[model samples]
Target: MKTLTVFTPTYNRAYCLEKCYHSLVRQDNEDFIWLIIDDGSTDNTKELVNQWKQEKKIDIKYHWQENQGMHGAHNTAYKLIETELNVCIDSDDYMADGAVERILSYWKKYGNENVSGIAALDATIEHQIIGSKFPEKLNRATLFDLYNKYGVTGDKKLVYRTELTKLYPYPIFQDEKYVGLAYKYYMLDKQYEMLLMNEVLCHVEYLPDGSSLNMYNQYLKNPKGFSFYRKELMKLPFGGKVFKYKQAIHYVSSNLLMKNPKLFIETPKKALTVLAFPLGFLLYVFIIKKTRTEVN
Candidate 1:
């Protein structure tokens, strides 16, 4: 069995997915399996992955299923992953050179049950670190604190233990996709702090089609999913008052979008939710207007 599984959840991104494949082929360490979750793509994704599988240069496992959105694809990936460790390298992203070797080596030296897994830097293709490197001399911190406390900004790559990743599956709401993937990470944060590595493990590209680029649209389309995530975040034990209030604001907005009358009743932080109502309603209006403008 491989030590790590490098899984990619892709929709109809076969055009640019080849960059990820070639990067994997160039890996200095081959102890990772590439699992592709084809989330109901209409394009030639199946054909492209099939061709790569036949080449036999690296281990590839491909699974196809109806469109259930990104979280649904993630649910399937967790179920099928057999490795001890796993990292999601998005279809539009690729590993930095020797990233696998670096991850495996660093983990071997400092990893243990005390940590959930490693949290490493992500860089642009031009090799600029997405944000400040992990706090100097800080070895471990929950994902939430890394931002709220340490002031670390921008996206980072996460490598998690398979057992932990399987624990909190994102809820699948009918007709809605796009639950914030951070929901599970924050849940894990309640129990474990991650080993912080400053090395850039992955290079990311934010295409127009990528979810990050169109979040207001996602916010409108996935109200139920976002509502569920916000409610859960409000319940997290670690987040501070302001953080919880921010989640409450989003929670209120999502419920308002759903037209769920019991917004206050459904909230985990009722007081915060009440306090956040004005801002949340304003945010709700802003989202509606913003998305509507984009559409028109």
Candidate 2:
């Protein structure tokens, strides 16, 4: 089996997906499989991928399913991955030069049962790091500490054990399509720490249509998904009261957006939920106003 499975979950992104494909073809190392999860594209994405498959320049696996949003596509990827390790490279993103070789080499040296996998850097198309690099002396840490305790910022690339990624399949809400992808990472944080690599693994471009760029709109459209994510975060064992309180604020707002009556009752931290009510209500009103203004 290949050492890594690099999966991309794509919707109607065929226009930009070719950039990701060419980058994979240029890899200095060919010891990885490219899995494309086609999330119900009305475009010519299937034909595009079929041409790439015929080239045989690299191994490719493709699966097409009805549009279930990003998190649902992730659910399918985790289920289908047969490799020991897996990393998600977004449709509009591509691996950095020599990234495949770097990852396999690093894991060969440091991987063991004690850890889950590696957390590496991500960069912009202009070759700038998205956030601060890992602390020079730091070796391993859970994804949570890399932000909360260490003062690290911005999005980082995560390579996780396929077995672990499969453990927390994201829940699918009937009409809602947005769920914070960090839900699974935080769950893994409870069980294992990951080896940190400062090397850039992927280059990301946040398109206008991408979820990261349109979060307020996502909040308005996917209240149940957001509410469920916030509630899960509040239950993490390692997160402190302050962290839980912050989650409560978002939780309250999401519930309000959905008009759920049991906000306080459903909250994992009831007192914090009560304390967070004022701000949460304000937040709900602000989101409503913000999206409304955009619409007009």
TM-score of model 1 (CA atoms)? 0.99
Q: Against the true structure, what is every candidate's RMSD?
A: 0.7, 0.7
Q: Write the per-residue lDDT of candidate 1 for residues 1-296, one digit (tens) a residue.
A: 89999999999999999999999999989999999999999999999999999999999999999999999999999999999899999999999999999989998999898889999999999999998888788999999999999999999999999999999999999999889899999999999999999899999999999999999999999999999999999888887899999999999889989999999888888888999999999999999999999999
- For 97-146, candidate 2 gives per-residue lDDT tens digits of 89999999999999988898999999999999997998999999999999
- List clashing residue pairs in candidate 2: none
What's the true lDDT of residue 15 in model 2? 99
In angstroms, the error of model 2 at 269 is 0.8
Clashes of each: 0, 0
Global lDDT for candidate 1? 0.94
